[model samples]
Structure formats: C-alpha cells, structure tokens
Target: MKPAPFLLTALFSAAVSAAPATHMDTKAATEAVSVYYRNPNPDRALKIMQTIIADPLWKKDSARHNLSVWAAQILRQHPQATDKWCRAMKQYPAVTQDETAYFFFLANTSESRKCLRNLNISNHSKTYIAQNTPPDISSLSNISPADLDALWTTFYATGNPKAVEKVLDRVLDYAKAQKAQEKSNHKNIDMTGVAAAWSARSNIMQNQDIRKIFDTYLNRLNATDKALLQKILVQE
Candidate 1:
C-alpha cells in the first residue's frame, strides 16, 4: 500500500530534523562550536553535543567531524574532556580536514601538527586555515570589509590575541583607506577603536620590548588619546 502524502511529508520533516545541524560545511561547524564555547551555558551545550555524538544512527563521517571539532573546543574550555573525544576521532578515520586542523590548534602537540600537515585538505580547508589561524596577517587582505568586521568582533569576544593581532593589522590598513576616502581630519577619526586594538595587541605580546610597538602607534595621536592609552596600559 502507498503511503499518504501527509505521512510522507511528516516523515521527511522528521528525517531532516533528526539529521545533525551543521553550518554550510565542516569548517562552519568549527566556527559555530567556538561561539558555543563562549556562551554562559557551556555545560548545557556540552551535554547537547555529547548526545549528538552518542546517537547510534548518526553517520560515522558526521559524528567524527562533529566530535573532532567539538573536542578541540572542549579542550580549550575543559581540558579533561579532550582525551575521550580525541581518541574517538583517531579510532574513526572519517574525521574531516578542518577537524584535523582544529585538533592541531587545540592539542598544540608535535604529533597533532604532524597530523595536520599530512591531512589531505581541500583548497577550501586551506583557505579556512589561512583565514582563521593566528600570526598570519596576509590572509586578511583577501577578505571583505564586512567579514573583517565580523572577524574583529569574534576576536575581541574570544580575547584570542593571536587571532586578534592578525586581524588588527588588517583593521589598521582598512582604517587608513577609510581616512583617505573620507578625507577626515586625523584627529577627528575615531581612534577609540584604534586604542582598544593597540591595547589588546600590547596585552598579547610576550616580548617586553614589543610594548614599544604599541607606544609608537600611540605617539601618533593627540594628548587625550595618549592619556586614554596610558590608562589602558596602567590597568594592564
């Protein structure tokens, strides 16, 4: 006997709902998991993720992808949970390229880097690393202004200085272009953001002398701006 049209529609909806909710791609899932990490209810998010990982009917590839990404994020927030998820990913070879890269970033182990370097990443995954990894400013040149803004917001929220510095340099370059385009007085330009960015940069710099870099940038501003920076530096 044929199924009713309404029953078929309901079945399709159920199937889609039961499927894992990932972003556009595996990399997008990485980003989403990062956002979830910063949320106040991280424990709740963890429980939900654990349920997803344990779902027997879930595709092995999708589970591996989700668990690997979630594992790296969990390591950053809760280090103890790392081993179980990492082991699961290793046991299941279906983990995606982005997940492997994330593992390297979180694991910070030689073995993890070796694994990342050997993974067969697609051009898209390479682009993701170029865009997201810290200490790489060149990638910012290829991104759009809106995306750069979003990147700035995320970096600021995460307080991940390495990632912040990469985008901060790009923001400075973008600010320069904005200045030229608007023909605004240098003093009139909103250097509040500039100060915040520089302060964040200073906080992240491990080298004591690198504070000079922020100082040099601060010197270009007016006395009030200099004072504001001084306040930030003092607080730090």
Candidate 2:
C-alpha cells in the first residue's frame, strides 16, 4: 500500500517543528527587529521599535516579561541603567544573553559591542564560545535545529567552506539517518519515528540559508555525499 506523500511530509514536518521553540514576542516586536536587519538604515529600526513597545501591552508590569529582542534594542540605547536592565532581563527569561550579545554583534555599533563585552556570561560559556567561535562542524547535529540554524547564521555572517560543511553535514546526518532507519531504531525506538524524516517533499536546499551553503560548498562534498544530498533534496 502506498502512503500519500503529503501525509508523510506533514508528519515529518510536524516532528521537526515540534522541537521546543524559543518563546516569541508580539508580531509587532518581531517585525521591528526584522525590519532593521533587512534595511539597516540609520535610526529607523530603533524608532519603529520604540513606537511598538509603547503599546499598552508593554506598559503593564505583568506583561513586561514578554518584551522581545526589538524592545531590548531600544532599551540598549538608553543611558546605562544596570539595575533596570538586570531586572528587565531577569523578567523576560526568553530574551537571552546570547540573543542580546548576538544582536549587538550583528548591530556592529561601538556601543553595542561594548555592551556585548560587558555581558555577564559565565566562564564556561566564554570558553565554549571561544573554542567554537567559528562553530565546530563535527558537532552541529547534536543541538536543536533552532540552535543549529542560529549557529549556522552566525558562522555565515563570515562565510567559509568549513562552516558550510558543518551545515551540510548536519543536514546530511538526518538524511542518512532516514536512509538508515531500519538500523537506527534498535538503539532508540521512542524517537526513531521523529528524529529523521523518511523523505522530504521540500528540498532543504530551497531554504535560503541552506541554499547559500550548498552553492558555496558543493564542490567540497564527495561524490557519495552529493548523491545523498540529491536524493534528500528530491533532485534527479
């Protein structure tokens, strides 16, 4: 009996998507930050964010915990208020120091860089980051896909074949798992159904981030790996 392709696709997609997602902020707050990234024009992102946070939802002390990265950026411009910043960051557990540091890193403002340097990150985090500043390729698949994407994006900020290789390897790991499903299950039955999709209707290469890496690192992959990618991507 043939299983309809969409059902498998949807089931696999749902499994992949079911990974615990980082909490999100209001749509307005998200757009404000995305707007800045797309354009990066002078003060517009900041001004837009400033306006968005002024919404009544943001004013309530109880709701302040949901403040997004966009709101945090506007707050970054305020005069040094360590106590306030501490309290606010404490409240919004979702708005992480990693997000904040990465935001400043992307912003590339002198003040923002200073803020990153001052972040109260632990020594363990500092060492892990220093070791994996470029991010290790061999271990990419061990983390959640969201973290994988974030790390890939960070490494892509300064593109290299090594980083691209890591991204492709992570994708390949799952694809191979799909191929090796019969063998992988004996080790872990509870998650075998969800850890890897049997097939992908959507070529992962279609994703812009992944596509960029594919285009950049196509030659670096061996013939066998390339063939595997073609299968996973549903290409002839």
Candidate 3:
C-alpha cells in the first residue's frame, strides 16, 4: 500500500534536506518556494520560509543573494510580513547589504522605509539607503525628469522591469499631451526615447509583454519623438 500524504511530504523534505547545501540547486529551491509558499497566513508562510533559509546552504553567496531577492519580492507582495522579514533578514547581515540597499532605493512609502531601516545591515548599506531613497511619485501628471531618472537608476540597480514600465507610462502620457497640442515640446525631459533606450540595455526585455508595452505606445508619439526613439533604439 502507498504511504500516507504526510509520509510522502516528510520523505520529500528529507530528500531535499539530505542534499549538501553546496549541492542544492538555488533555482530549484526558488521555484519550489514560489509554487508552495501559499499559506494564507503571512506568519505561517514566513515560518516555512525561515525553515528553508536556515539551511547551511544559504551561507554561500549565490544562495544568500537568491534569498535576499526573494525577501524583497515577498515584502513587496505582503507588506504585513515586514516585522518578521526584517528579523529574518537580520541573520545574514554580511551578505544582505546590497539587497537591503536596493530594497531601500525602491521603497515608496514611509512604512517601507521604516521596515528597511530596522534591518541590521552594514554601514555602507545604511549610508547608501540614507542617501538614495527615491522620491515619491505622488502625481503622474506633474511627474518630472528627475522622477524618471530615479526610476531608471532603480531599474539598473535591481533589474526590475516594472521601473521601465513606469518610465514608459510617463513618456506615453507626455507624448499624448503633445499630440493633442500639435507641438512636441515638453519640460526638456528628453524622455521620449528613454524607455526604449534603457529597456534595451537589459536582457530582461526578452519578455514579450514588456517589449509590447513599448510597441503599443509607439504610434502615440509625435513624428519627432518617433524618429528620436528609432534612432536611439538603433544606436542602443
């Protein structure tokens, strides 16, 4: 007869645990977490996550980097996990400095900043966070070149495509505004080509959906902007 469901789960866990930390596949672990970490209670999910992270395998740089990136993604999804996540991240301060720095740069709210501040990160990360938290994009209508520039900085720092999307939205809006006015002038932002140019710099644009966002708005830009974008894309 087949073993019970609990017995199967125990056996699987044991199989994974029996592998040496260095031999464990980081991608496999991350994929498993994404698939199975769906507990409704954030605390319970955090507990399960903590169990995995506690493995000696995470002492390696590659594993720790994956863990930190996963931590940032989870925090973005579930801000309620803040206190627990910070406490957990504390256990690997030496390796988390870059992760925490990127997290602080992308943090958009006071509460998010506070949670990042609570982490026991290194002085280098602390200084970078204090100097580089992005300004709030409170009003897209009044968005400035500085705002788009900051988002690009975050994109390069974290390789998150959503940042490029934000720039694309702003450029599209500005293009539409100019088309309505029959004039291509704006606040000297030169943003018409930014989304296409910067997005091309990263391999992440391989996502057809992201590339589609640029194409969807291409017809909306004025002739001048279109020519500039085409030139930039070719040059980039």
Best by TM-score: 3
lDDT of 2 by residue, 50-161 (tens): 4434444344322232223233333344424333443433333333454334334333345554655667655654554445443233355564433333333333223334
Per-residue lDDT for 36-76 in model 1, tens only? 52462434444544444444423344334334333443444
lDDT of 1: 0.43
Ranking by lDDT: 3, 1, 2
Off by over 4 Å in 2: 1-44, 47-141, 152-165, 183-210
Candidate order by decreasing TM-score: 3, 2, 1
Better of 1 and 3 by TM-score: 3
lDDT of 2: 0.41
Worst 10 residues of 1 by lDDT: 1-10
Best by lDDT: 3
TM-score list, all predictions:
0.33, 0.41, 0.43
lDDT of 3 by residue, 87-173 (tens): 665676555434544443454445567766666666776676667644443333454444444444333234455665666665545
Q: How far out, in Å, is residue 73 in model 1?
A: 6.3
